[model samples]
Target: MKAIRIDEFVRDLATLSPKDVPSPKPKGPRDIGVQITHAALTHVDMLYAQGLHQNNGRHVKPPFILGNEFAGIVTSAPPSSSLRPGTRVFGATLGSFAEHIYADENGLREVPKQWTNAEACAVGASGAISWGSLVSVANLKRGETALILGASGGLGVMAVQIAKALGAKVIAVVGDEEKARMIKSTGADGVVDYHEKDWENKVKAMTEDGQGVHVVYDAIGAVESGLRCLRYRGRLVIVGFAAREGKMENIQANRILLKSAMVHGYRFGEDGRQDPTRTEEVWNGFMDLVVKESIKPIIYKKNYVGLESVSQALIDLGKHTVWGRAIVRINEEAERELKARL
Candidate 1:
């Protein structure tokens, strides 16, 4: 089997070499062996490559595979999982930068017939993330206002659609004028460029009372300066430190106390990696939105370069340079053609 693996933490994404590894073999009752057709690359992979998340024991420790989200066809499954062979699907399984991956059936979702492989790829991580990071953490309600940073990336794009679907007004922040327009395309009420010197102030000026948005989805935790953009009693959800690495948000506790504000931290892996209930909530919410045509994701380009491309993709993501979810696609033309049929 062809796969990409890291031998050591290196500065270069091109450094991790691709090689042939033994195909994955299935284990006991809960597993499903998937002939992975698409794998989405995210910043977590780059952080893992830089050895930033040593806390996770599952990381590649030299000659190890990395990746968590993939869309594929199931080749085998345990009856207990209720998944059948040859089912078109998408799912999350850590270490999926390979040709074949084995995932617990519950972690895998049956992709809808109308959806393409690229679209289904968004279901696992991007779709699930929108619910977990927005609904679970911020606890938003209809007619409320949300401010989302990094709103043009994989997760941000999904967040925008989710917010609008839930009937909330969204003020999204992007990297530049082009992304500003892109975020607006998702029905966001307003969009701001974080690169602008007064982006936070602009955000404050756009929402009610100039206090701040009712909910702040700060997935790019590199945005402590955006604190001034929060409303009184507004909740801020921190999903990752995309903007700031190893740097404290250093918010004034007094401010949070005075304004009755809330900061909710979320890690995608915490309790939801294999937890049936949390996984179910996230997936169910996503499917309902998709079926309603409320939260349509922008299926960015899917790359056919497998294994070896994972590392470079990760580094590109970490540096804010990836165009979209750079996926290791098993069959390039076939996947695109499937998506086109949708």
Candidate 2:
């Protein structure tokens, strides 16, 4: 098996080595092994590489496999799971940068037969986040309005579609003209260029329903931006912080009082201590969305070829060049695609 890994403290993309590693052994009746076709990169990967992620998954040192979500075919499975060997499937697992990966029965989701690997690979992380935020966290209502910041990136684009599918009027806040146009095509009622002067006030102007938007789905937690966009008694769901710094942000009592708002910080990792049942709930919900065609992540039509490409993918994510989530594929299937002529 081959894996993409880092050694020393090198953060450059070229430092990631694609090399042969021992294949994983299946643990128990509940564990399964998958042959990976694609692995998607999350902002979490860059943070993990820099030793800045507060999440528990990245606490260990490097020379480890690096990936968060994957889409692949099943090669083996425990008796407990419904998955069967040789099934054409797409699923997600943590630390899946190699050709063959070990997956818990709960983490796997069967891909729709007609969906392309490129499409299925793109949806894994951001898709789960978006679907979970709208239906699970916010419990959003139809005919309501949502203010989504970072609405052009991976998760944001998914949320835009999901919120629209749920019958909410979406006000997407993106960086510039091109991104705004993309959101517009997704049926957003309005698009604001956040790079413009007084972008927040423009959001305020677009709010004719009441005090402000019905919900503020802020993916980027910059401490003080989205709360101000909320209507009286609106809910703000903290989904991502691609813009967050070292520490958590402070909440002002006055602002909470003035708006009568609630701030719920959400992290989507289901197995990590806080919420175990979340996986089952989110898994069923995610499958529902996938089956219904309500939302899909807008995968950029490019693939970053090798382990060396992982660094640039992370850098592009930091520089905001990664439009939607970019997949860092490091499996035998991907290896064949890039290294071999086909």
Candidate 3:
């Protein structure tokens, strides 16, 4: 099996490449063998490559395959499992940038009939994170105004669309005019250029009566401004600290006290592991929105093909050049077949 193996963390992503590795086999009764067709590139992939992500040296160590989300065809499953041989599925797990992977039943889901493998792969982690932060944690309600920071990144774009599908007025805060325009096209009610002076005030003004947003979804470390954009008793969901390069940000207690706000730190994978029932509930809700609202994960315009392209894809993501999800096509034949059916 060919896989993007990380022998050790390196400072240069370009140094990382694919190699022939042993194919994964099912380790448990519920584990399913999957032939990976496509995988999504994320910031976390970059972090893992550099040994900067929390999961590195903790949940997983060096000398492992990289990548977390993938769409694949099941090669084997337990007789009692709903998934059988040749079932198309998408899921999140380590070692996705490979020809094959073995994942737990709880981590996998059947790909929607109408979706291509590339699209399904792109949605796995980003969709879960967005759904978990907004719907499960914040309880974002319809008709409410929600402000999304880092609105043009992979997770950010998914969050924007999911928030809109939930019938919330979405204010997307981005870095530039082009990003702002792109976010608007994805159903954001308004787009704010964070480069503008007093952008936080501008975000508040976009909400009804200038009262501020009902919820602030922060994927970047803009804690101070996020607090300012929140209305009384508003919820602030912290998804990541992309802007600060993974460094934690300090929030002022006074701001929370004054507004009676609630702040939530969201780690989608960890959350799902801790509470499988709630994770299922969140996933069901997310799929419902994806199907009913015709919500699709936005793929970047650039195409990354094959396991060898994984390094460049991760580099592009680190440079912040990818507007939406960066996807790498793994099994070209499988992807072609999946697209033909669609």
Candidate 4:
């Protein structure tokens, strides 16, 4: 089996390389082994490589595999589990950029019949986060309005479609006109270019009666301005800080106090630990959307081939040059099988 190994916490993507590692197997009856086809890259993977979590008391040391989510075929599974050998599945895991991965039955879900492995893999982390924030955390309702900041990026794009699927009027905030057009095509009612000075005001104006939106799904972490775009008692779901340095702007406490608003922070990994049931529900809801063709992952079309390309994928994600999500094709045989079926 081949895996991308990060021998040390270095600033350079050159540290990640393909190495032959022993294949992982199921540890127990509830565990399953998967033959990976595609692995998706996000800013979190880059943060892991740069040791961002290490300073914050996270035990992120070296000589470890470097991917967070994958889609693949089940090679081995216990008879007791619903997933059997040859089942196509996708889900989030700690280290998935490898030929084989071991996961518990609960962590994996069967992919839809229509989706290819690359599309399935593209949805894992971003899909879970989007569903968790809008459906589980915000309890977003139909006919309500949502303002999604950084709406051009991976998580933001998913949030746009999910919010729209939930029957909400979506206001997508992007950095430029091209992104604006792209998000507008995803069913957003309005697109606000955040690069403009009065972007928040524009969002407010687009809402009913200029009151503001029912929820602010902010992934850009522009909390101060995001608050200005919220209606009275609106919920602000903090998804990520991909735009800035992850340092939130100082917000006036009175803003939330006066508006009677609630601030909620969503972390996909933490949600699994805090409320495993809710996490599973979110994944299931996403799968349901897939089954209904209500949502499809917005994947970057460029093919990043093999373990050696993982570093380049990370670099593109860090630079924000890649739109939507980045996927690394790992298994040629699995890829062939997927294409044949399609």
Q: Which candidate is the best by TM-score?
A: 3
- For model 1, the stretches where C-alpha displacement exceeds 4 angstroms are 54-60, 245-248, 273-275, 301-304, 333-342
Q: How many angstroms is residue 54 displaced in model 3 relative to the true structure, after the best TM-score fit?
A: 1.6
Winner by lDDT: 3
Clashes of 1: 2
How far residue 239's Cα lies from its native spot in candidate 1, in Å, is 1.2
Task: Give the clashing residue pairs of candidate 3, or none.
Answer: none
Candidate 2 local lDDT, 1-342, one digit each (tens):
777654544546446666788888876568778888777877767766666677534454665677777877778887767888765456666567777888777667776764756577787757777777878888889988899888887788888888888899899988778777777887789998777887777888898744578888888774367877888888888887876633567767688778888777777774334776775676677667678877665776567765557767777777776666687655546434533542
lDDT of 4: 0.83
Candidate 2 Cα outliers beyond 4 Å, as residue runs = 56-59, 245-247, 270-274, 329-342
How well does candidate 4 match the true structure in TM-score terms? 0.92
> Of 2 and 4, which scores higher on lDDT?
4
Worst 10 residues of 2 by lDDT: 333-342
TM-scores for candidates 1 onward, in order: 0.90, 0.89, 0.95, 0.92
Candidate 3 per-residue C-alpha lDDT over 1-342 given as tens digits, one digit per residue, 9 for 90 to 100: 899888888899998888998878888999999999999987778888888877785887888899989999989999889998778999998999999999999999998877878888877778878988999899999999999998898889989999988889999988877777788889999998888999889998898889899999999878789999999999999998777755677778899999999988998888787988888888888888777855766888898989989989988877777887888998869757755775
State the C-alpha lDDT per candidate: 0.74, 0.73, 0.87, 0.83
Q: CA shift at 42, candidate 2, in angstroms?
A: 0.7
RMSD (Å) per prediction? 2.8, 3.4, 1.7, 2.2
Per-residue accuracy of model 4 over 1-342 as CA lDDT, tens digit each:
789866777678766778888777667678888989989987767877777753223555676777879999988888788898888999787678888899888888888778888888877768778988998889899999999988888898899999998999999988777677778887889998777887788899998889999999988778888889999999999988886643456789899998899999998777787889988888888777777888777788678999889888887777776767788988858768755785
Residue 83 shift from truth in candidate 3, angstroms? 1.0
